[model samples]
Target: MDFAFLFIDWLGKPLWMWLAFISIVIALLVFDLGILHRDNREIEVRESLALSSMYIGLGLAFGVWVWWQLGPESGMNYLTGFVVEKTLALDNVFVIALIFSFFAVPRKYQHRVLFWGILGVIVLRAIMIGLGTTLVSQFSWVLYIFAAFLVITGIKMLWIGDKEPEIGNNPLINFMRRRFNVTDEHHGQDFFVKKPHPATGKLVWFMTPLFMALVMVEIADVIFAVDSVPAIFAITTDPFIVYTSNIFAILGLRALYFALAAMIHRFKYLKPALAIVLIFIGSKIFIADLLGLEKFPAALSLGVTFAIIASGVIWSLIKTRGSQEAHSNGG
Candidate 1:
């Protein structure tokens, strides 16, 4: 076998580097599904936290390795991208919760939906990142477009504040219901079931509510990616760093969803903080141009990003501390 091709550069990184990253992801997925969660059960907050922590630790360790091998600049870029992507994905958790709730999906079946949804996300993000890298490499000015878009998005977030999506009125869901044979109730962990058609009395494949929830979850991620893909590209244009950091961050976030969804209302203030982060990230290019620097400092970006996200989390925890109790007590 001619393995020399592995040494060839694909997207500003050795082909093997991409392969190694893919291999790691596959192993993680296998271990996650084949071992850790082979059985369908409700993932408790404690278990979710532990799984999320392990994924986060592994992601951070990967950044350290990138730093050691690729240089501090690339390492810092990965960390920044990872942090930004993960923070942005918090909003995604809320949407997923809404989807599951609207569908009335069983807690035990939610993980299955999320697991498959993550698989779809991996593929979808790769395509988006690849297209983004191509655009940026061909036209350097596209970064500015992404920057401007991010700035506008951030401003919109600030102005609009947090609004729950009207999942019930979603056109896609309505279209799917009209076009496909969908079951009104869940069928355990199965996404599809063979059932007799109501009109024909013939066996047909019908999608369960579980499947509907999964589709909605995947669509929600794609919607969020519109903001996230550009945000990460604004950080660095390296496809390897952009894609790896994205997948890792998402993997951890999905694991954390079980816990976050239960307490999402407590983090009411995170949206504004995220808005600030986006504005800061988007403006970095223009700020650098104004200051006559080649680019924004990676270390400074990382530091500022961490500080903003940390402050938002702390502020949220403090402000919403008793809201949960109030709601529980019907106060």
Candidate 2:
């Protein structure tokens, strides 16, 4: 149809490209909710792995499509951003797991909270990326600030090491408790339920722990975005590439969560690898300046980043193998 080809430019990208991306995403979500996860049940590691593989495959496939349509440079940038965002989101998986445990969210209902949470993330990420794109367009010098921020954040992560979050004393949890009516227990998958007010004896909606957990997870993603958004901006300021890569990475997160949470201990080395990745990405811009290069080669950047992550994963597996065996034996 002529309608499909009548492309008006949106943010330097054609309407058709945007429409294609949106179409794929919509199809994936429909498949995810309507078909694959038609019934909410406890997702075992095997099922999680299967779903994760599908999402990861689709994300990479989109990169291939980018390569074909937009040429190698943009394609490489998309892949780089995708890899960076996916790895950065690993840290978030830890916090989400903690929130779920603290709220005592049953496995069956966990998907429901996470599914609705995706809707929030789609809107939230769009706003952040749109703002970031605007800032970069208006003030080109902002890239330097992003680079500096990434370097500092990476160094801070190295210094602080990994520590489990203390959810019991989280200020947000405390604030929510003080400000609203919170049920003492989860009400199935419901985020809210109508119950009689203690003082007024009038029916009022009370938030369940599941809802609070969802809120906390959303907040956690926002916090992580502070690090991730800058890292992606440092990679390439293309709004289309940035947004697509970020959303694709996030689309798989819930599926990845089940598999990763169960074996989080095996990823002990991933944090340092991520820190190094951030530092490398941040430093590339400055390094290009000294070398009189327009920009670092996208292919080289992607290769180095992937190599670092692979090394970290392999080393973590080898180092943690004994501990895993010991735990199994003891059990």
The lDDT, on a scale of 0 to 1, for candidate 2 is 0.91
For model 1, how does the per-residue alpha-carbon lDDT over 98-208 read when each residue is reduced to its tens digit?
A: 999999999988889999999999999999999999999999999999999999999999999987789999999999999999999878898999999999999999999
Residue-level lDDT tens digits of model 2 in 9-114? 8988998888888898889888888997888788899999999999999999999999999999999999999999999888788889999999999999888888
Runs with alpha carbons beyond 4 Å of true place in candidate 2: 1-5
**True lDDT of residue 168, candidate 2:** 88
Residue 311, model 1: Cα distance from true site in angstroms = 0.9
Best by lDDT: 1
The estimated TM-scores of all candidates read 0.97, 0.97
Give candidate 1's TM-score.
Answer: 0.97
RMSD of 1: 1.5
